[model samples]
Target: QKEVEQDPGPLSVPEGAIVSLNCTYSNSAFQYFMWYRQYSRKGPELLMYTYSSGNKEDGRFTAQVDKSSKYISLFIRDSQPSDSATYLCAILDYGGATNKLIFGTGTLLAVQP
Candidate 1:
């Protein structure tokens, strides 16, 4: 199994729609879960990071992690056209430094005006 997998969605939504993206991982040793947002060809910006199982909220974005199922989710509320971008889920190995991030194939989100 791949260490991490995502749908790579070209998910489209009207302005103000709620967006949910998810990923699953096979590595039980992953302890740090993160969500990143990237615009066009730019590098991803860290959106949220959580340790183990729990929920972390920031502005319009919320990240949830379920360690037992090896799943993670990112939810965007009140989405806007400016929110259109690729969202990537990442996990850090238990042995690595905080800087090491293993990413999933990103989900593309398009918020239409």
Candidate 2:
């Protein structure tokens, strides 16, 4: 299996809906999990980062990691049109600087009016 797997979701929902985006990984060495939000062609902005497991919350965004299940998820509460963007999950391997990062294909989220 690929190191990480995620639905490249062009998931559309009306404004005010709660959106849930997720990713699954097959690697056991990945310890750092991150959630990024990107608008159009711009680079991603770090939304949340966790060293291991548990949940992290920031504003309308919440990130959850379950190392035992190798799964991660981002929950956006009270969605808005401005929240329309691609969400990407990234994992940092412990290999060193050369290890770089592994990214999901990214889920395209559209919060409609």
Q: Which candidate is the best by lDDT?
A: 2
Residue pairs clashing in model 1 are none
lDDT of 2 by residue, 1-113 (tens): 88989999899999999999999999877889999899998999988999888999999999999999999999999999999999999998767555677899999999999
C-alpha root-mean-square deviation, each candidate: 1.6, 1.1
Which lDDT tens digits does candidate 1 get at residues 15-58? 99999999999988888999888998798998889999999998
**Model 1: runs farther than 4 Å from truth?**
96-99
TM-score of each: 0.93, 0.95
Best by TM-score: 2
The lDDT of model 1 is 0.91
C-alpha positional error of residue 99 in candidate 1 after TM-score superposition, expressed in Å? 6.2
Counting clashing residue pairs in each candidate, in order, gives 0, 0
> What TM-score would candidate 1 get against the native?
0.93
